[model samples]
Target chain A: MIQVAVCGPRDASEAERAQAREVGRLLAGRGAVVVCGGYGGVMEAVAAGASGAGGLVVGVLSLSTREGANPHLTVAIPTGIGEARNAAVVNAGDAVIVVGGSWGTLSELALALRSGKRVVQLGGWRIADAEGAPLDGITRAGSPAEAVAATGLFV
Target chain B: MIQVAVCGPRDASEAERAQAREVGRLLAGRGAVVVCGGYGGVMEAVAAGASGAGGLVVGVLSLSTREGANPHLTVAIPTGIGEARNAAVVNAGDAVIVVGGSWGTLSELALALRSGKRVVQLGGWRIADAEGAPLDGITRAGSPAEAVAATGLFV
Candidate 1:
């Protein structure tokens, strides 16, 4: 199964949280493993969605305690590297789907782009260059279904 | 001298590059040392500006090779931790000044905020919460001078 990272903030709105959950559910339903930052908000929502669907959920935590992860995670990786673990999350995912806006989401987007990984934005940052040109290959999806479909994982 | 991190993309535009340079010079003029991702683009520009002003600059490179740092850096520390080295940049800086927008810049901002470090945005992200309130204490400056001054390091 392909690992899909659903990244966003720990304090997102309810709509954004719902979007993340749907994304997680869709990805998991398609036999894809879901990965997240392993904290609250969107992470918790994603983990809960995947777990509710009996899908494998991995939490790459910045803290050193497995208990630090959301209760839905099937596997918890405590890196104790703080925000640096963002790299580990991106590296572990086959593709990354950004659910909403946050500095951490932006970082994951940057790393994914730099590494030439497939990046899909559900409702987050649309970064561009100084000339107003899109720097990396960033795809925008209007819905969770489109976002997971765009990943081409199920195909 | 205080250590300030000047973070942005390695592929910044000419204007953003110039902005980074001025930021570096301003920081150095105040007897402050500059730190960066230690690659190209804004990092190189900041290092150049500081080195030209006879100020000290440290490049915390993501690569293990010291040669990966820009030539303008006075000291090079290669972590080989990939993008994870962003944690090192934030930890080494007494404060951080974001010169432009990028995924890497966004990550640094998040990490700095989480750690409760002083963050000054020159021309980068303007992050807000779900309620449209500033999530963290983000200081915005119109010019590089104002940005560096707002850091309150020279005070």
Candidate 2:
């Protein structure tokens, strides 16, 4: 099954959470495995959405044990690597869809771009060069559907 | 002993390579273990420097086996997680030092910052907000010695 990594912040806004949930549900409906950070906020939202749709959700947890993993995950891989697990989350996905931005989320975006993985950003922080020019790698989408469509995996 | 993560691009300039080597050497001299990405360019250089200093160097490899690990490492961990191992590299360190810039390097830097680990930049691409303001949290150093000092692990 195609694994899609969805990255976002734990301290996310309501809109971002809703978008992530919708993205998760849509991805599950397409028979894709949802990958996430396995904590609270956007990760929990996405996992909930996918689980509600009876889809497989894998949480690449930073903890060594599944102590804090969200209940929606079908499988939880506790990495015990802290924020470094951000790299694993992005690497597991054939494509990455970012719902919101945080320092951790930005790391995943950068890692995905570095590895040449297709990345689609929903509502998130903007990144630019020293001169304020936007870095070219990410595809920005307006809604959850647009974000999934931007991944170009289903089509 | 303290472990320091050294992050940089595989395709590095001569200056960056030299700086990474010096950083490794200094860390080793201070009795710290060096952690790196375990491939070519800056990683290889840092490993060489640490090994030459009779210090332990850990190469956190992305490959499942020790296919292309630099010979300078004292330990090789083949994570088989591709670029996801980048997170492991940073997670193993108490502090992170960046020699230069690349998409991968930037990801490490971001991850380190997100984890609240002290990060020092030797020579790297600069990150700024969309409004042209430089992001806070990175300690900029002019030289390898300065970078090592900035980590605050030696003191």
Candidate 3:
């Protein structure tokens, strides 16, 4: 099954979290496993959404314990390697869907760029500089459904 | 200086979240850097705690589009690599301290074990079963002070 990882805030606001879960739900409905860092914020919200929709959710945990993870996750992969687990999350996913924003989230984007994975950006921070946000040209979705549809072309 | 990484649960029931932050504070007191996936949960919480306690926090983000790191982070390593950003988190930390747990946390643990880095488990899920948990007979600390102290033996 294709894994669609939703990377974003760990303490996301209610609205952003809702958006993340909706994205997970739609992706899970498409039979994709929704993957995340697996704790709170976007991870928990997305897992809840996907699991609510009867989709498989996988958590790429950085700890050796299970203190973190959504109640819906089907599999737990222990990287025992700290941030290196991000690679596992990115590698497992066929496509990358980033939401909200964070430094770790940005790193995930870099991984996607390096891995050549299908990338999509949802509501979050933007990568801007003197040359405007470069990601402005990349795949950007305004809603969960649009993000789902946008992924169809990538897969 | 030691480097510790914490991941899992943003709104982790106040108490749980408190413990994560306390761990970070303890680590930071030793002039160690708190490295994390760098968003929220134990990651942001600990980063906040560490920075509040005058410790350096480096956020190894996984996306480039979003660099919204926690307020405590001193350095934002924007990794525009998607999930591949996990590798940077583990590599950056000198001693990886795991608090709470999740699949992403687990994957990080796996990478740490694969790299043979000194790992300290405060509390969380079990990564191994029949093969046994990585770092068998490893020192498990209940408090952040002990966890940081334990890190000294390895590095």
Candidate 4:
């Protein structure tokens, strides 16, 4: 009954793209809708994998002018908010699954922090300062499977 | 020296991809560092365009586990936070530009609104009113030139 939101770099590297797809498969196999920024890289890979299994995929786009939605997306929630569309993803997910990322990834982590949502970091860079003020309710997993499993157990 | 972030669905249709690439070129020619989810679709397009023009591009990635960074990224800020990466994108940009989208894009949009970032929707849906309250300073543009102009004027 919960949706798993996948967020990552739009121009993800090969390995990142592969990881995202695997994660999507895992989520879809469990019958969760896959949500993402929705154009390419990690987002597209995940959507492609999930949709291949007959899973529903949602995309919240930021195009204010002419950009269009990804073809893999089943539902498109357009937010005329420009790049701020990131907020909707963090909020929509019951649990957050992160794959390969950059700055956008960090912000989504922050959103999870702000929302008190369950956050599981897979394989990427350490964005927060654990030594300083550790994030509350955030758990770090060694792999994608571990990350998704924690969603059922943790938040 | 303001940074502008752009993102969208990864598995974009041909039309979305073309539009994203054009947006990337426009952003680069204007001398702005285009930030993105950092892997594919609009992220790669914007980063390639900006980097090619000697402009700066930063990618905030979510792969703390093992995913790699995009080749076009000049500066990669890996968060290892996974889907929460959306929050990072909204936080990093000085201003925001949106184009085609998905769930992650919506999350970014929500984060931008919460952060009070000025956003210019480019070619997708307009930011909807939340609980009957409209965003305070969102701008609408129909073309890349107008969108960029709006970002400049709004910021």
TM-score for each model: 0.87, 0.83, 0.52, 0.50
Highest TM-score among the candidates is held by which one?
1
Residue A69 local lDDT, model 2: 90
Error of 4 at A7 (Å): 0.6
Task: Tell me how many clashing residue pairs each candidate has.
Answer: 0, 0, 70, 89
Selected candidate, larger DockQ, 2 vs 3: 2
Q: Chain B alone, TM-score of each model?
A: 0.95, 0.98, 0.86, 0.84
TM-score of chain A of 1: 0.95
DockQ of each: 0.36, 0.44, 0.08, 0.03
- First chain TM-score in every candidate? 0.95, 0.98, 0.91, 0.88
lDDT of each: 0.84, 0.89, 0.70, 0.70
Q: Pick the candidate with the highest DockQ.
A: 2
Once model 2 is optimally superposed onto the true structure by TM-score, how far is the C-alpha of residue B125 displaced, in angstroms? 3.2
**What is the lDDT, from 0 to 100, of the residue A138 in candidate 2?**
85
lDDT of 2 by residue, B42-97 (tens): 99999999999998999999999999998999999999977777778888999999
Q: Clashing pairs in model 2?
A: none
Per-residue lDDT of A1-155 in model 1, one digit per residue for the tens? 68998898898889989998898888778889999999899999999888888899999998988766789899899988878898899998898888888766777877777677899888765554434455548888999899999887778
lDDT of 4 by residue, B70-133 (tens): 6888888877766657767867788888776544564575567557787877555333221223
